[model samples]
Target: MIRFDRVSKRYPPGLDALSDLSFEVAEREMAIVSGHSGAGKSTLLKLIAAVEKPTGGAVLVGGQNVGGLARSALPYLRRRIGMVFQDQKLLFDRSVFENVLLPLSIAGFPPRDAAQRVRAALDKVGLATREKALPIMLSGGEQQRLAIARAVVGRPNLLLADEPTAHLDRDTAADVARIFHQFHDVGVTILIATYAGELFPGARRLRLDHGKLMA
Candidate 1:
């Protein structure tokens, strides 16, 4: 769950990314954030992930104030969060399996356990057959699915996606949206920042404009 109370983020030279933003996302709930470029969508996600500190007020995830979290405790906090970015951020030189295995490796899971988790994640994203393939060899849609697999391989409780379907065609975007729904059905709290929010019908909508929440 995420809660923000009058949160404001201002960079040097007085640029405000978010101003007095307040919202709450309950456990196991799915919500979509819509905004234009420079509308603070990504900044909102970064605040929840503890990647950026707020200039005022607070950001709390799972009941702990993220801004108050110690640097030493960040890894622990992040272990409960899964993030997918628009860029996919894949390493072309690595195989799909290796890419999905990075997080588990960082968390020190045993080799055999991590291998099992990697395969399960691939299977969930319909990429089990491509585990040995390179990211460059896949289609855009497949590459995005691989990124999703990598994010969920750790079985995070909260999933945050920033423009997950930004580059795909309508059908592919729908496919990606279904994948997110599958995870949500299984109790993963999901918050997606997207310009193509029509893909997520019936979900709670949060719109931001010029760093402020819109009514």
Candidate 2:
């Protein structure tokens, strides 16, 4: 569903974040991006999300060139992709349900429909009972699950997670991976950027080194 053709991005201060990175992620395929620090894995994810544009080449999603999308269309493109991060990125002030509903709210979905979707997403992430809780009140794993719920509440076609299991314990990391797999089983394309190979043994591994992909 996503392809990068000879893409490269270099910052102004002479730092090359990514170099000649080309890869394709098929629909419904779950893959892990593996690399050490400064290996360009996070840079790749940012490019896919359009948080930053490429300095060269193209980033194609479902045949549309995201690199060339109009500014007015960027939000629509991002709504089709869900992203989770190591920090969870939850708002301390909002209830879990409210946090999950932010995307729907931004899209101007009606209140009732947005609430229903939020509840469903929470249920999918096994956090149905925790909807009214605050982020500061939940455990680390629960907070991470909340992040996943927020990401998938939009029913995105592609899910990108960066260091998703970084702060969790072994069993919790395994649980989170299983949750991601469940999303994959039902047809969401999953691409995870992680350094923990042992945590994702069955996933297709794409190794990155020094801003370049390695075999």
Candidate 3:
């Protein structure tokens, strides 16, 4: 569902975040992007999501060229892809349900439909009972689960998570991993950027070093 054809991304200071990176993650496939800090894993995911454009080459999602898309067309493209950011990016002022509902609302989903979708997403992440709870009130792991719920509530065909399991107890990380496993079983294309490749052992690996794919 995602293809990077000779992609390169360079920052303002001539930092090459990704250099001629080429790879494909097929529809419904699970893959892990492994690399150390400054290895460009996050930039790769951003390119796929069209949050950042490539400096060169093409990023294709579902066969559509991401870099070539018009700004007005991005929302429709992004609706099919979910992202769980490294910071979780939850709104502390909102309740869990509201957080999950935000994406659908932004997409102009009807109020009734959005609420239903939000409830289902929370259930999937095992957070239904806590739907009314504020993000600040949740434990760290629960907060992480909340982020996952929000990402999937849009019913995205592809899910991209940046360091989903970082900074948590083993059991909590295991819990987060289990949630992703369920998503994979149901045929969501999954790509995760993480240092912990062992967390997703069955996933195919794409190793990056200094902005280049490692052999």
Q: Residue 79 in candidate 3 has what lDDT?
A: 90
lDDT score, candidate 3: 0.94
Candidate 3 residues lying further than 4 Å off, grouped into runs, are none
Top candidate, metric lDDT? 1
lDDT (Cα, tens digit) per residue for candidate 1, span 1-215 = 89999999999999999999999999999999999999999999999999999999999999999999999999988888999987989989999999999999999999999999999999999999999999999999999999999999999999999999998999999999999999999999999999988998867899999999998
Per-model root-mean-square deviation over C-alphas:
0.7, 1.0, 0.8
Q: Could you tell me the TM-score of candidate 3?
A: 0.98
What's the TM-score of every candidate structure? Answer: 0.98, 0.97, 0.98
How accurate locally, in lDDT, is each candidate? 0.95, 0.91, 0.94
Tens digit of per-residue lDDT, candidate 3, span 60-161: 999999999999999999899999999999999999999999999999999999999999999999999999999999999999999999999998999999
Residue lDDT tens for model 2, 137-160: 999888999999999999999999
Q: Residue 198 error for model 2, in Å?
A: 2.5
Q: Give the worst 10-residue stretch by lDDT in candidate 1.
A: 196-205
Error of 3 at 14 (Å): 1.0
